[model samples]
Target chain A: MKKYFLPSLKLTLVTIILCSICYPLLIALIAKLAPGRGDGEKVMVNGKVVGYANVGQRFSDDKYFWGRPSAVDYNSAGSGGSNKGPSNADYLKTVADRIDSFLVHNPQVKKEEIPAELVTASGSGLDPHISPKSARVQIKRIAAIRKLNEDQLVTLVQQYTEKPLLGLLGPEKINVLKLNIALDNLK
Target chain B: MNTEMIGIIATFLITLILAFPLGKYIAKVFKGERTVTDFLLPFERLIYRFCGIDPNKEMNWKQHIIALLSINMIWFVYALFVLLFQGNLPLNPDGNPNMTPDLAFNTDISFLVNCNLQHYSGETGATYLSQMIVITFLQFVTAATGIAAVVVLFRAFAGKTTEKLGNFFVYFTQTLTRILIPLAIVIATLLAFNGTPNSFAGKDSLVTVQGDSVQVSRGPAAAMIAIKHLGTNGGGWYGANSCHPLENPNYFTNMLEMFAQVVLPIALVFAMGFFIQRRKLAYVIFGVMTLGMLTFMIPNIISETAGNPAIANMHIADAAAMEGKEVRLGVTASAYWQVVTTIISTGSINSMHDSAMPMSGAMMLLGMMTNCFYGGVGVGILNYFVFLIIAVFISGLMVGRTPEFMGRKIEAREMKIASLIALLHPFIILAGTALSSYILVHFPDAGWAVKPSAWLNNPGSHGFSEMLYEYTSSAANNGSGFEGLSDNNIFWNVSTGFVLILGRYLPIIGPVAIAGLQASKKYIPEAGGTLKTDTATFGIMTYAVIMIVAALAFFPALTLGPLAEFFNLK
Candidate 1:
């Protein structure tokens, strides 16, 4: 017992120092060279911080492309999903409300045509990108509200759509925050 | 082929290729043989010296278990203390408050058992000090503890009627310094380079285009995320887990995280073969596990990709179940992750599981309940052995001969212990779920401080699943939740804490005890009529036994939760 105790205590201290202290410090030093410097990548617009490129932000206006619905109201402090199982009454109600609101905003689009991504709250509650179809579905509403050429707006959404990484992982997505920023910048 | 299919195939190929050599190396490490890591022996010797441990000293299974349990108990207390007083501790840059006693208890046991179930959100619940000292520290040691326990069993198998199984402290420390640490360092470095945060700073405030300012929490997340996956300790530094962009920066990192979680568990299977020189038996077990995994995985992928039928009926055109899933992962990768995480008991998620399609939820539950399908760290093999014993017993009975395994007779005592351990998993999960359901059903408005209504985000069958998944995850020591259960309360914390203890220790005790007893028994040579456990027929029989046990025990609760949800969608 004594033999095991003394060794166990010593090893615990060594591991704490190695894993809990030195290891993190070393990783932090490496992270200093990464994109965000271990802070999140901040999106800037005319010298003002306008959210993070990686995180999803809520965009409710018709003139801008909408992102996925957020479960935590896009609170970066508390990122999570609504965690509502599909059959959950509250979850069904929330999705129904989102669909109704989306239909009212995009009057040109039929109920069936609205992409599921637009109504469903994202896993992180901060999905920065919407599916390309979700982006395309909102184009007519954005074009009418912003008074831009429909073709040009369609081209803009295309320009913002990111292809799957190495064409073998994830899916095609359009960054709603970036697309909307570009919309505000348009002449 | 589509990118999703290509990605899935590539993941499997790469994992198999890497795990092969890793298994051989792990076998060498535990066997105390000459290897590439021999240069690090001086350092290992120094660890032994510092602890006043004689590396040459061997312990019986009793001493090994005692060493493993006592050290773990000490850690449990240490973690409990750190969690309770995290606000007062240093390195708390965010000034996160101390945890309530119940929350602390759950967190401690969760991590201690390698469950990593987070009742509280990471950023708010724990300080940086607690994350590093308690959570990350346990991630390393608990994983090492599991490997050590299995190494003892390996000794029992390899050596003929040996009284001593190896030195527990030696195996534990060496596993940390050699295998887990090296792998974690490389992965952590890659994660940091790929933009996971490794900072000491607090939340960064940012103004959105909508002109609303939001504060985003940042910390030394990369280091924690690395070990969390590598050790199969799945608690996330942030609440969102791998879905967080920083935790999983891009596609490459996603692949890396998935690989890390399964590599050790898979490699350990091969390690078993290499150590015992029974490569054929290992292959049979591996085949059974892979077949079981694919059977669950393929259906889940197809169901998720086919999109939700209910949503389809509503005339939604883009029907893939995108809710609670990252576009970066999509349906295929998310579904794949769901199976992999649950299968290995590495409960980290790349997406929200609660929002997954009903069938996917059922597959996840099945993975946890059966658990032996390439389980977590060393424990995976440990749980599988329980099934192996039952399979051997049944096969013996079928052939009208007494069963013997690895030269040891399989008798009443071994079978009783195996049966008890096997049955214990479903018993705890079902009983806990039933109790929680009764409380919710009978006392909707009863003042237990937290109302039953407050317990579930969804009502009815889906709600029942949320409760069931919680206890299942806890009892499996898997730690991934349905995420809809508001479980940071006294009832959940206390109940799951006990379940975690029972689930973790009993399985360990049962398996190790059986192996110990088997090792001590008289050796019997192979005869003409001796059943070849390495044969394909034995493998199929083992698979059948696992399925039968799981179906008989869990089918009813599963029917209520995910199955009902599945049919309802139709």
Candidate 2:
């Protein structure tokens, strides 16, 4: 026991330095070459930093494109989901309420056109992307509020839409932060 | 197939293809044959010299157990103290407070056992220094520990009757240098470029385009996230784990993380085949495991993609299962990850398990309950080997002949150890759940940090499932939780802490002991009377043994929790 314990402790001590210290240090050094300088990539508008390119934002205004309902309200520092079970009565009522409110805000948009992603809270509560269908469904409301052409808004959503890997894998998603930023800039 | 389905299928196929070569490479490394990774010998020698370890010194199974347990003991003690006082430690820019003794006990044991069942949120509960030194450090060594433990079994099988299994330190260090470190660097590099933060920066405050103020947490996440998957240790940098955009970033990264966790477990199976000079045996084992995985995976995918029935009642358009899921990966990809993570025991979730459909929950439970369908790291194959022993023994009983495996007869002692290990899993899981349930019903106001009444996040049957899931995760060492369960209290922490130790060590000890005993037995060459353990019939028998054991032990408990919820889903 003594023979094994001594060596085991020594080896673990050395291993800690190698793994916990040197490994992450090496990775951090190489990460200097990555975007955002490894401090998280920032989304800048002109000369001012608005937010992170990957982190979602709260967009409750009727004039802008909104992402999915975030359980954490897009507080990136404390990210999490609703964690409400599928069979929970209160959770189902919350989903129903989200649907009704969407119809109230966008009376022109029929209930059948509302994508589920828009009504439901994302797992991370910081989902930057929305389904392309989610983006398309909100075009009319955004056009009416911003006084922009509906076809122009649809084209913007199309242009901002990100395709699946090799166009044959994953779902087609549009980055809502990028889309809404473009909306504010569009004539 | 739909694009999401294509995503799921392609991920699985690509992993299997890559695992073949990786398996052969791993076997070569363990056998001390020359390979591309030989360049790492100098570094390995340095680690050996510094630790005063003679890599050539071999040990019997007993010494190997002593060495493994002692090292884990050192880790648990050191990690517990550090976690208990992490607030006072340096690099805590986020100012997360120190953990109570109970939560620290649970957290330390969880990561030490390679479970990574985080009772506390990673972003809020842990500091940067603790994350690097304790959590990420445990991820590396614990995974290497598993690889080393399995290699002892490999060396046992490679030789005739003998006691010289292998040097534990040699296998441990070489695995770290030759396999885990190189693979981790590649995965970490890919993640760093793909938007996962890879620096020492603290949380940053920013205003959105919509003029909303938000504080975004940033850290040395890319490095930790890489090994978190590479080692099949699924504790995430953030509370949401891989679901967070910065942690997983995108679909390609999702596929990469999924592939990273699975490839090693599959490769280890092939490695066992190569080490034993029986590739066909490996194929049979692989076939059985893949089939077992698909049985759970298919139901999970169908249920998750079908959308939740409760939301379907809302008469809303687009009734896809989007709650607690991301749009980028969609439900199909999320469901695929759910099965892969649980079945493999990686437990890094991209979708919230608490909100998944009832059928999906049942499949996840079965995945953990079986716990051997392409399991965690090297331990996965070890668990399957136990099941194979039971199958061999049962079949021998059926035919009135002695059961033989690899060249040795399956005697009573080996059978006893295997049976105990198998029973231990269900016993710990069910007993822990039962205790929690009893507390909730009888002593809801019992004075703990968090009362029993506040333990559940969802009510009725789903809530019962949460208690069941917590224990199952701990006992299986799978680590992914229902998330909604408010389990950061003394009762949960203490109860699951003991469960984590027994779940991890006993099964490991049982397998190692059996392998050692088998190795020391007189080797008998193949004969006509011996039941051919490598045939397709044996695979079916082994699969039957696994399903029967899991179903028999867990079906009633599962019926009460997930099945009840499913039938009552509006």
The most accurate candidate by lDDT is 2
Query: Which residue pairs clash within candidate 1?
Result: none
DockQ of each: 0.70, 0.87
Task: Give model 1's TM-score for chain A to 2 decimal places.
Answer: 0.95
Task: Score candidate 2 by lDDT.
Answer: 0.91
lDDT of 1 by residue, B1-570 (tens): 678777777887799899989999999988888998889999888878887889899898889888887788778878999999999989887778999999999999999999989999987888999999999999999999999988888888887787888889889988888899889989998888776778898888777788777888789999999999988889998899998766786677888999999999999999999999999999999999999899799998988898777666667666678888887667788889999999999999998999888999999999999998989999999999999999999999999988989888999999999999999999999999999999888888777668877999877788889999999999999999999899998899999999999999999989999999999888888898888899889999999999999999999999998999889875
**Top candidate by TM-score:** 2
**lDDT, candidate 2, B1-570, per-residue tens:** 789888989999999999999999999999999999888889788888888899888899999999999899999999999999999999999899999898999999999999999989878999999999999999999999999999988888888999999899899888888899899999999999999998888899888888888899989998899999988889999999999999988999999999999999999999999988988999999999999999999999889988887777777776798889988878998999999999988899999999999999999999999999989998888899899999999999999988888899889999999999999999999999999999999999988778899988899999999999999998889999999999888888889999999989988888999999999999999888989888999999999999999999999999999999999987
Candidate 2 local Cα displacement, residue B131, angstroms:
0.5
Over A1-187, each residue of candidate 1 has an lDDT whose tens digit, in order, gives: 6656767777788889888998888888878887878776778999988887787887876777888888788878888988877766666667778788888888998998888878887788878888778888888898888788989988888898888778766667777788899989888
Chain B TM-score list for all models: 0.99, 0.99
Tell me the tens digit of each residue's lDDT in model 2 across A27-89. 898889999889888988998889898888899999988889999999898899999988888
i-RMS values of the candidates, in order? 1.4, 0.9
